[model samples]
Each structure stands twice: as structure tokens, then as C-alpha cells.
Target: MFYNREIYKILPEKAEEFCDFFEQYIMPVQIKNGSKLVGKWLTESRDEVMVIWEYPSIEEYRKIIERVSNDQIGRKHQEQLKKNQPYLIKTEQFLTKRDKPERSNQNITVSGYIVNDVGEMLLVRTYWRSDTWELPGGGVEDGETLDHALCREIFEETGIIVKLFGITGVYSNGETIAIIFRGKRTGGELRTSEETKEVGFFPVDPVNLSTYVKRGKFIPRVLDAMNGQYIPYEAFQVRPYKLVKRYDGEI
Candidate 1:
């Protein structure tokens, strides 16, 4: 499906009036022209309104636009919009193709298990949780490869350079997928960033580590690397917004 996401940055106090105008004057005309009203939402601050319209394809979206341009009721709606323009500060629209329903809800995270020359594993204490020691990693940013994100996150949290060895494992918990990679410390000194309060190498075995490190979620991944077990990374070809190709290989 094709989506027309309309974002309106309106005067803070005029959000309700803008939404009322959309419902009464704009929605009916768009609906009559082969568009489905996906939903409308107001921001918590009451300063922005968002409306979503769906079409089967870009061609259908174009047809709807043409129909709305020619229809008498749509023309009247445009006139009303001019009179209410003062309420709207700015408007932005985005054309996007919707992904498959099954794949749309998944979130991806990348992590690195970097072991130093002394066999101690690198760990960090995040600013948000100074008491809990966790592996250095973060969510994959848009358009960034998993390995790149892993390296970037490791560097951001712990001031060190790492060379990725291979995939450690892929873990899933509900709607989230975590890709852990085995890495070796290559350069840089032990340091901390704004996001991290502490950065250092600790004993890999949970029995030899502090309580916080022993109870952290990355212990399993650390143990797996020490045992020389690595899962084959899966490669994917994302076409537009959907996964078009997937194969067993390094990502």
C-alpha cells in the first residue's frame, strides 16, 4: 500500500480547529476519491496533527489527486482551507510504500562482545543504569549496516577500536531481535563517553565477575564466544520497504 502521511504544524491552541476542519471538509472528499482514512492523531503537546491516507499504489494515489482536483466538493474544501490558513503554521507530506504487515513490527539491535588481550571482556555502565554493567551496544540506526552500527556503538560507549570476528548469535525476545557479534580489541585506551559512566575489561566468567556483570544479559553471549561457537550471519536484500531477498551468509 502507498501512504500519504500529512504532518501539520499548527498554532498550539488551534490544533482542535485544524482537526475539525480536516474531518468535516477534507476527509469526505479524499474518501470519495479512492483514499482510505487510515487515522488521525494529535501530538501530546497539542501543537501538531498527523493524518494518514492510504492507496493501493502510486498510480491510484495520482488518480485520487486528480479526482479531488476536479470535484466540486473538493474545490470548496480548498476554499475553506484558505480561510483557515492562519491556524496552520506549516504542512509536510511524505509518500511511502507500506511494508508487509508481518515484518513491519520487528525492531533490531546490535551488540559487540569485545575481549581484550588479557581475555577480559569489555563492559560499560550506561548513564541510565550506572549500577548494571552491560556490553557496549545500541539500536541500529536507519541506513546503517549491523556491523557498522555495532562498531559505532562500541566506540561511542567505550573509547576503543574493535575488529569484528563473526556473528556470535541472534536472540529474539517478543518483537525485538538482538544480533551479537564477537570482536577483539584492536586499539584505543579505556575511556567513557557521555552515555557511559564507566568502561573497562572484566573477567569473562560470571563466577569471577562482580554481581552486576554476572547478572547482566550479555553473559550468555560472552560464554558462547569463549567456546568458539558462532552463528552464520544472514544477508538480506531490502527492496523499497520490504525484504526482497534473504540468504545464509555474512550480512
Candidate 2:
């Protein structure tokens, strides 16, 4: 287990604003990424605030931090901090470890890289991610298989039914695990859904990938799918169990 003892010194007049900012921009994201708040305290003068966070492991702590910094909401949080710097005087942190603590549930997501015979990859632009085109996908519904979830998401977002090649890559960032699959469109017309603003196929040019995908974390997933390298992935049952299926060798 690891703990983060975070101390924030702020102007007494800015205390309310700081607390609001923390609650609105920071606390939810941290909790969503598997960090737990042990407690929060305010000093006698009310100029200093103390927060303790518990994590199952140091590695998990690092992943939560990294994910918060890379994701869209995290980016917004950073900008808010810079924009509201006057509320903070100084920040201090302490990291220490002991026995591992209980961990929160992790969110699982699936995405697909659907390429056409002509070499262009299917991509979508959402309202939140309008800056760069990204693969179409979403959170896995409870009890759904990864491959099935990906197929359903693709159809919902881009109206495309796909012939999956296999698992192209897997990624983990503390609280979330994303499985990326490689495939090509088998049928269905291109149409935008409520979650997507635009949907179409675009050329996958390595030299110009950055122009299409500006998000650092998303670029590698696209690149891996483009290269055609695959990881053998399978899902199985445990209890009154069975071998559900596998997504491999099709690439």
C-alpha cells in the first residue's frame, strides 16, 4: 500500500475557491482512477489544507497520476490550475508505503481500428475530442465480452459492421484497461451517432499520424494496429464455466 500526504497552502480568502476547484476538477477524477481519500483536514487558521490518499501499490499510484495527466479531463484540470494559480501558495507531497490496501474496481474499455481495402482507417471525432480523430469505441458493458463490446460500439458510433482481425494491442492506466483490435469494415453505411460528430475513413500515413492524432496516448494504439502485429487474447468462464472465445490469429 502507498499513501500520499498532500498539503496545500492557500490564501485564507481563496480557501473556498480552492476547495471548490479541488472538488470540481480533482477529487472525482482521482477517485475515478482508483485513488481513495483517507481524510481531509484544515488547519486552525484555515490557510492550510491536508489530504491523505491511499493506493493499493506505488505502481498503481503512478498509473493513476499518469492517467489523470494524459486524459481529457486531466488536461482541463491542468489548465484550470494555471488559470487559478492565485488560490495556491505552495504544495507539498509525501509518498510512503506499507501493506497493500483494498483496490477499487477498474473500468474496462474497447476500441477498434477498422481499415478499408484501400488502406484508410475508420476514425471518429467526438465533441469532447474534436482536436484529433480517434478510433471509435466505448466502455464495455457489464458481462459483455471484449470483442462483442467492440463490435457493438463500432456499430453504434459509425454504423459499421466489421470483420475483426484480432487483438492489436492492450493498454492499462491504473483504473482503466483498454483493448484495441484490428479489423476492416465488412458492411453498413457511414452515419454519425449521438456520441460521434463525424465518422469516416482516412489514410494512415505514419509521417502524418500526428496531424490526425494529437493525443499522445492514442497515437501508439493506432500505430500498433497499423503495423498488423497482434496479441493472442481469449476470454474464459470460471464457475459453471466454459471457454467463451478468443480473438487471435485472424490478423
- TM-scores of the models, in the order given: 0.52, 0.58
Model 1, 1-251: lDDT tens digits are 56788887788788777877887878877765556788988999998888888765566577678878876778998888778777775565756653534234455788887888887889888644456787888767556778888889898778899988678688886556888888789998888874676889987575665564645566676666566566655434555565433323232
Off by over 4 Å in 2: 1-103
Residue pairs in collision within model 2:
1-100
Runs in model 1 deviating more than 4 A are 1-103, 214-216, 234-251
Q: What TM-score does structure 1 among the candidates reach?
A: 0.52
lDDT per residue, candidate 2, 1-251, as tens digits? 46788888888887887888889887877765556788888888889989898875566688778867875767898898887677675465767643456544576789998988797899999755678899999777546888888999999889999988688888998777889999889899999875577999998788999988889999999888888888887888888788888777574
Worst 10 residues of 1 by lDDT: 242-251
